[model samples]
Target chain A: MSRVCVPRDAATLAVGADAVAGAIAERGVEVVRTGSRGLVWLEPMIEVETVAGRIAYGPVMAKDLPGLFEADFLNGGEHLLRLGRPEDHPWLAGQTRITFARCGILDPASLDDYRAHGGFKGLERAREIGPAATIAAVTDSGLRGRGGAGFPAGIKWRTVAEAPGETKYIVCNADEGDSGTFADRMIMEGDPFTLLEGMAIAAFAVGASKGYVYSRSEYPHANATFGAAIETARSAGVLSDFDVELRVGAGAYVCGEETALLESLEGKRGQVRAKPPLPAHQGLFGKPTVVNNVLTLATTPWVLAKGGEAYAALGVGRSRGTQPIQLAGNVRYPGVYEAPFGLTLGEIVNDIGGGTASGRPVKAVQCGGPLGAYFPPSLFDTVYDYEAFAARDGLIGHGGVVVFDDTVDMAAQARFAFQFCALESCGKCTPCRIGSVRGAETMQRVMDGVDTEANLALITDLCETLKFGSLCALGGFTPYPVMSAINHWPEDFHVVRDI
Target chain B: MTSLEPWRPERGEEIIAGLTRLDGAVLPMFHALQGAFGHVPKETVAMIAHALNLSRAEVFGALSFYHDFRHEPPGARLVKICRAESCQAMGGEAASRFLLADLGIDWGETTPDGAVTVEPVYCLGLCAVSPAALVDGQPLGRVDGMLLVEAARA
Candidate 1:
C-alpha cells in the first residue's frame, strides 16, 4: 500500500485537511495524519512517500482528490498542485529550525516516532550532566524568553533552582492569544514531546517534580492533540518522575503574562500582580516556580543536544538561536519562518513574505502582537533582534509580523490599539484600565476632527502614563501601536480636521 | 453537540462535586457545567461556592472575569468572528458587517428565533488564512459572510 500523509493541524483542518484525508483514505490508501509544516498558504498540504523522498502537494481540498488519484499523486506523479519536495522549498530550506525540527515531520502521539526524530535526547543529556551543568548549558546558550519579555531563561531557572522551597513548579505559558502569532500553538500541536522534554529538563535543573501547561480554551484542537501526547509520554514512563498537567485557560488574553497566569491557575481572576516577588520566587500557590514560554521551553532540548556554544553561534547580539517568525495577515505567502535574529524587517516582510496579498503596496507591518509597534516601510531597515526593536519602540513579541496594504486606515488602527487594551486589561491598575478607555475615546475624538490637536496631545500624555504606571506589558506596550500610527502617519489623524 | 440538557440543580451539584478534588476546581467546574447545560446558569454560583467552601462572591467574580463563561443560554448555534488585526487586514470588518446585517443582529446578540448567536473573538491563530471563524467549535478559514452564514445554518 502506498503511504500518504495529511496534516491534522487546526489551521489545515479549518481549510479542509480532514476532508482531503478522508477522501484519500476511502480510496484504500494508507493515510498518516501529521502536524503542519507551517507553510499555511499551502496547508492541507499532503505528501507521498516515494523511493526518492517525500513529495509535496497542497491547499488540497476534497474535491481535488479524484483528479489527484487520476494523476497518480499517490506515487508522486505529475500534478498542478505538486510543490515537489518540501525541504527544497525556499521557505522550509531557509529556516534554521532548532525548536521546530521535528514538527510536522512525525506523528505527535507516537512516542516511537518522537524518539526516532531525536526527541528526549536533551532530558537524557541533562540527567547525565546533572542539574547545575544543565543550568550552565542554558545560560551559556544565550537563549532568552521568546514570549515578548526577552528575559534570560537560564537566569529564571537558576533563581527557582536556588530559591529555598521544598516544592517548586514548572509552568509552561501556552496561553497564545496573540492574533498574528501561532508558533506556540503549532509547537504544542506538532511536537508536544519537545515541550515535555524541555519542561522535564527544567524540572531536573530546579528540583521541581510538577509541571503545568496553561493553554487557551480557544485552541480546543491543540489542547486535545497535546493532551494525547502527554498521556502517551506518561504511559511510556517518559514522564514517570515529573508529573505534568494541562490546564485550560478561560478566554483571558491577560493570562498570557506569567504572574497573571499563575493567579488564574490557582482559580482566581486573571489579574496582574506587582513585581519584586517575581514568579520565580512566589508563584502558583506561592511556591517557587520556573515559568517559561512554550518556545523558550521547547528550544531547551536543542540547546542541550548540541553544546550551548554551538547554539549561541547561530544568532546576533543578545538574541541567540533561531526565532520562528510568523508571517501573517495581508501577506502573500504567510507562514512560520525560523531564522537567525539578524534578518531585517524588510527582508522578512518583503522577500520572505512576498509583500501584501492584496497586490497593493505594503503600508505598515505590525511586529510582535497587538502591543507591538506599527512600522511603515521607511523603518523596515531595523533588524529583528529584541534590542533593535526596542530601540525603534517596537517589540519582536512572540515573533508575529502582521502586514497591511496601502488601504489601511492608521487612525482607526490607532483607536483599536487603545480599544484592545481597554477590553483585555486586568483592571488591576488604574493607568491601564482608565487610560485605555480614555485613550480610545480621545483617539475617536481626534479622528472625528473635534479639537484634533488637543485630543492628539491628550493621547500622547495618556500613553506616557500608561507606559510608566501600568503593571504589565498589556498597558506598558499598548502605546507602541497608538503612537507609532500618529508619528508615522500624522496625515491619517488630520483626515477630517476642522475646516 | 448543539442541543444541551436543561439546567438542573442535582446535575450541577454532581458536576461541582466531581471537580472539587482538583487544585483549582472553579474554572474546570464552570467548564463542566457549561458543557452539560448550554451555559453556566446563574444559580451555579452558590452551588459551586458551597461545594468548594468559598464565598459566592469569589465564585461570581472568577466567573465574570473570563470571557468564556456565559451567563445565559445562547441560540441553538453559535458563530464567533475574529476581531483581531490579522483578520481585520483581510477585510474581516466588511465580512462581519455583512454577516450582522444579513442576520439582523449585532455583535453578541442572537436572532429572534434563537437559531444563531454571534460573538466577536480576538484571534483563532489561523492568521495565514485570514478572515477566520468558529461555528460551534468548528474552525473555518478564508471565510466570507456567506461562508459563515452557511456554516452557522448547517
Candidate 2:
C-alpha cells in the first residue's frame, strides 16, 4: 500500500499534495486525508508509518524536508520528539469536528481535495432540490449563526430570499473579533472553498448576483487564504457568474456588528447604524442584503448537501447541530472543539478542556465572545445551548469559553468589559458611548473602596440602561459581563466605606 | 524611469502623464507618492494636490482616515498587545503591566531607543490563546509575562 502524507498547513498541502503523490509513484499506498488533530501549535504535523505505529513530530516548517527522510520518519522510530497515533491523543479524540470537518484533512485550495472529502457534495445535492428545498434542509438542520449572534441561519436566509429588492447582496461577516474564537479563521485558512461554496449557496437562495466577504485585517493568513480561494473558485467557474469581492476591514471591533460591518464595507467609518431599515430592507449601497456570520455560511453547505433532518439530528434545545466551541484562557487544552450543543459547560470545561491550565479550580467560564456573560462555577452545570445560557443570564456568544482560575479578579474583569465597550463603541448611541466610560469610572470607584455599595448599584443600573437603550449589541450587550461579575462574585465588589 | 525632481510644476506634469496611461489614476497616484517616501512626504502630497487640482487638506483628510497611512516614521518594531475582551480575560492586565515595566513605555508609546513601540490593539483574532500579542504584525498566542519579555527582547 502506498501512503500519502499531507502537511497540516492547508495552503502548502494544497500545493504539495501533487508533489507528494508524484514522489510516492508506484509505492502504492492508499491516500487517506483525515481531519487535523487540532494541534495547531504543532502544525504542519505529519505522520508516517513504522513497525510500531504512526509517529508524529511537528511544527514541521517547509525547509525541514531533507532531514526528515534521514531521520527514518517512515518507520515511526523515536527521534527528538515523537507522538504516537494522533487520533489517540485525548485532545483529538475528545473533539467533535463538524464545521471544521475539512481542516487538516484536505489541501485547502484544491477543488479535488475538497470534492474527495465530501466538500461540494452538499452544493451539488442542494442544486438538485432547488432553493425551497435547500431552505427546508437548513431549517431542519437547526443551524444558528456561529459568529456569536446565535441567530437561526435558515430564518435569516428565508427573510433575505423573501425580501423585495431588484438587487440583493449576500454578505459574509468574516470580521471575527471575539477572543478565543478562531473557528472562522481556521475554516478560512484550512478550507476556504467550504466558505465560498456556502456563500454561493446563500447568494443563490437569496437571489443575490453579488457577494462580499468582509474579513478582518488582523487575520492576514485568513485574508490571503480566502483571497486565493476566491480566485481559485472563479477560475474553476464555481463563482464565475457571481460578483464576489473580499473586503478587508480596517481593524474595528464595532464593525463585527452586522449594520456596522455594512457601513465599513461602504468605505465609511466603522460606525453602528440605526436599525429598522435592517440590511434585509435596505443595505450595501441601498439594496436588500443578507449579512451572515462566517460560521452561519460555513454551516450552510452541510445543511443543503446532507438534507436538513440530517443536520438537525445533533444538538439539544433551541441550539441545534454542532458548535465549534473555542476553549481559551486558563484551560489546559486551549483549542477549538466542535460538539453538539447538548453538552454541559462543566463537561466541556472539566472533561474535554482538562480544566484550568494553572491546576486551579475553574472560578468562572466566560462563554461566547467578549460580550458574553461569565458563569460562576456554581453554574458549571449550565448546558451549552442558547436557552440554557439565557436562563442563567448568560449567552453562548460565539461559543468561546474562556476559563478563569482563582487568581482572576471579577471586579477587574467587569471593569475591562466597560473599558472595552468605551474603546470600541461606534459612538452613534449615547448609552454605549457615554455609559461605558461612566461605567468604567464607577467600577474603578468600587474597586478603590469609595462608596462601594453605591458604586456597585450605579454600575448595575448603568448596565441595565446600556442593555435597554443602546442601538446595537455593542451597547446592548455591554451589561452582560458587568452584571455577571457583580451577581456571581459579590465579594469582589465588597469594599470598606468610611465617613 | 520617471524623473525624481521635486518641483511642483515638473511633478504635476509627471502625475498628469502617469494618469494618461491608467484608467483610474487618482488612488494609484496617491499610493505611488506614499510608496516612494516612508510617509506621504509633504512635497509628494503637494505634487499630487497640484496634479489632481485638489486642495492639500482633501489629500490629508483621505490619508488620515486610513490607519495604514502614517504621517510619522514608525519605530523599529511594532508591539500590538491585545487589549480586547478575549486577551483581557486571559491575564492580559498582568501581561500589559509586565510589558510596560519591561519596555519602560505604556500603550501607544514608542521606546526612547526606537527599539519597540507598544500599542493597544482591540483584537488580533488569536482569542483561542488569550493574552495574545502581535510583534510587527506576527501574532503570538498564550503570551504571559515571560513571553512578553522574551518577545520584547527578541
Candidate 3:
C-alpha cells in the first residue's frame, strides 16, 4: 500500500489542504496528513512514499485528484505538478534546517512520527548531560534570542536556574504580533511537538516545574494545533517534570513585549512594567521566571541534539546559527528560507526570492517587522547579522523580509510607521503616544507641500525623541522606517514640495 | 465566533466561579465570557465583578483596554482583511478599494442586513502568500476583491 501525504497546517488548509485530503481519502490509499514544508506556494503539496523517498506533487486541488490518480503519481510518475524530490528542489536544497528539520516532513501530532525524525533526541541528551551542561551547550552555541532583542538565551536560563525561589516558571512568548513574520506560526502549526519538547527541556534545564505558552488570539489554527501537541507530550511522559498552560492574548500588539505579555498572562491589561526586577528575577505572579521566544525555545531541542559547537559553527560573527528568514510581499519565492548569518540582503531577496512577483525591479526591502527600517537596493550588500543590520540602522528581527516594488510611495510608508506606533503604543510613556501623532501630522504637512524642508527636519527630530525616550521598542524603533525613508528615498519625501 | 444570542446568566456565573482560584482571573474570566457569549454583555460584567470580588468599574476599565474583547455581538459571518505592510506592497489597497466599493461598507462597518462584518487586521501571518484575508477565521491568500467577497460568502 502506498502512503500518500497532504499538509494539515493552517496555510495549506486555508488554500484547501483539507479538501485535497478529503479528495484523497476516497481513493482508499493509506493517506497520511503531514505538516507543511513552508513551500507555501506549492502547498496542498501531496507526497507519496516511493522506493527512492517521498515523491512530491503540488498546490493540488480537490478537482485535480482524478488526473493525479491517472498519472500514477503514487509511483512517482510524471505529471504537470510533480515537483520531483521536494528536498532536492533548488529553493529548499540550500537551507540549513537544524531547528525546522522535521517541520514539513513529519506528522506534527504523531509521537512515533516525531521520534522517527530525531524529535526527542535533544531532550534525551539534555537529560543525560544534566542542566548545567545543557545551558553550557546553548551558551557555547552563541544562541541569542530570535525574538528581536538578540540577548543571550543561555544567560537567561542560567539566571532562572540560579535565582532563589521556591517556584520558577518558563514562559514561551508566542505572541508573534510582528507583521511579515510567520516562522513562529509555521513551527507551531507544522511541528508542534518540537515546541512542546523544547519547552519541556527548558523547564528541566532551569529547574522550573511550570510553563506557559502566551500565544495571541489571532492564530486560532496555532492555538488548536499547539493545544493538541501539549496533550500528546503529556501522555507520552515527555512532560513528566514540566507542566504547561496555554494562555491566549486578546488583540493587543503591545502584548508581544515581554513585560506586557507577562501582564496579559496574569489576566490583566497588557501593560509594560518597570524593569530592574527582570523576568528571571521576578516574573509571572511575582515569581522567578525564564521568558523566551517560541523560536528561541524551539531551537533549543536542536542545539542539544546536535552539539553547541556544531550549531555554532554555521553562521558568521556573533550570529552563530541559521536564521529562519520568512520572505513575503512582492517576492516571487515567498516562503521560509533558513541560512547562516553572512548571506547578504541581495542573496536572500534577489537570488533566493527571485525578485518581485510583478517582475519589476525591487525598490526596497523591510528587513524586520513593522518597526524595521526600509532599505533601498544600494544597501543590498548588508549581511544578515545582528551587528551588521544594527550598523545599517536595521535589526535582523525574526528575519522577516517584506519586499516592495518600484511603485511604493516611501512618504506614505513613513506615515504608516508613525501611525502604527501611535495606534499600538502602550501609553505608559508620553514620547511614544504624543510623538507618533505629531510625527504623522508632520508627514502630512510634507505631503500637503507646506514648509517641506522644516517639516522634514521636524520628522527627523521627532524620530530621535521616540528612539531614545520611549519605554519599549514599539515606540523606540518607529524611527527605523521613518529615518531610512528620509535617508535613502528623499525623492519620495520631496512630494509636491514648492510646486 | 461572535454570536448574536444572549449568554446565560448561570453559565457566566459558572465561568467566574471556575476561574476564581487562579492567581489573576479577570482576563481569563473575560475570555470565558466572550467564548460562551459572543461578546461580553454589560450584565455579565457586573456578574464577573461580583463573583471575582473585583469592583465593576475596575472590570470595565480592564475590558476596554484590549481590542479583542468586544462590547457587542457581531453579524452572522465575520470578514477580516489584512491591511499590513506585506499586504500593502502587493496592491492590497487596490483590493481593499474594490471590496469597499462593491460591499458599500468601510473597514469596520457591518452590512445593513447583518450578513457580514468587515474589519481590518494587522497581519494574518500569511505574508508568504501575500494579499490575504480571513472569513470567519479561515484564511484566503493571493486574494483579490472577488476572492474576498467569495470568502465572506463562504
TM-score of every candidate: 0.99, 0.85, 0.97
**Per-residue C-alpha lDDT of model 2 across residues B13-116, encoded as one tens digit per residue:** 46545753432243445445433432355555566566666677765554444444445544677777877656765678788899899888877777899777
lDDT of each: 0.92, 0.74, 0.87
Best by DockQ: 1
Q: Mind giving the per-residue lDDT tens digits that candidate 1 earns over A365-402? A: 99998999999999989999999999998899999999
Tell me the interface RMSD of every candidate, in Å.
0.7, 5.5, 1.3
Tens digits of lDDT, candidate 2, A1-499? 3253554233233223334434433345454443344564454466675555566656454445556546665676556645667767766776666677777667776888888888887778777888887877887788888777777788888888888877898999998888767778878877888888898888877788889888876776677777988888888896647767787765568888998888776645567788788788788877888888888888888788777887788889778888888887787776678888889988998988889877988898888777989888788889888998899888997778888888788988898889888888878899998999999999989988988988888888888899999999888998998899999999988844352
lDDT of 3 by residue, B1-154 (tens): 6544477788778878898887677887888888777678778779877877778887887798787787777777888788889999998878887887777888787788887788788888888777988788787788898887776766
Give the candidate number with the greatest lDDT. 1
lDDT of 2: 0.74
How far is each candidate from the true structure, as Cα RMSD in Å?
1.2, 5.8, 1.7
Of models 1 and 3, which has the larger lDDT?
A: 1
**What order do you get sorting by lDDT, best first?**
1, 3, 2
Which residue pairs in candidate 1 have backbone atoms (N, alpha carbon, C) closer than 3 angstroms, thus clashing? none
User: Which stretch of 10 consecutive residues in model 3 chain A shows the poorest summed lDDT?
Assistant: A490-499
The CAPRI quality class of candidate 3 comes to medium
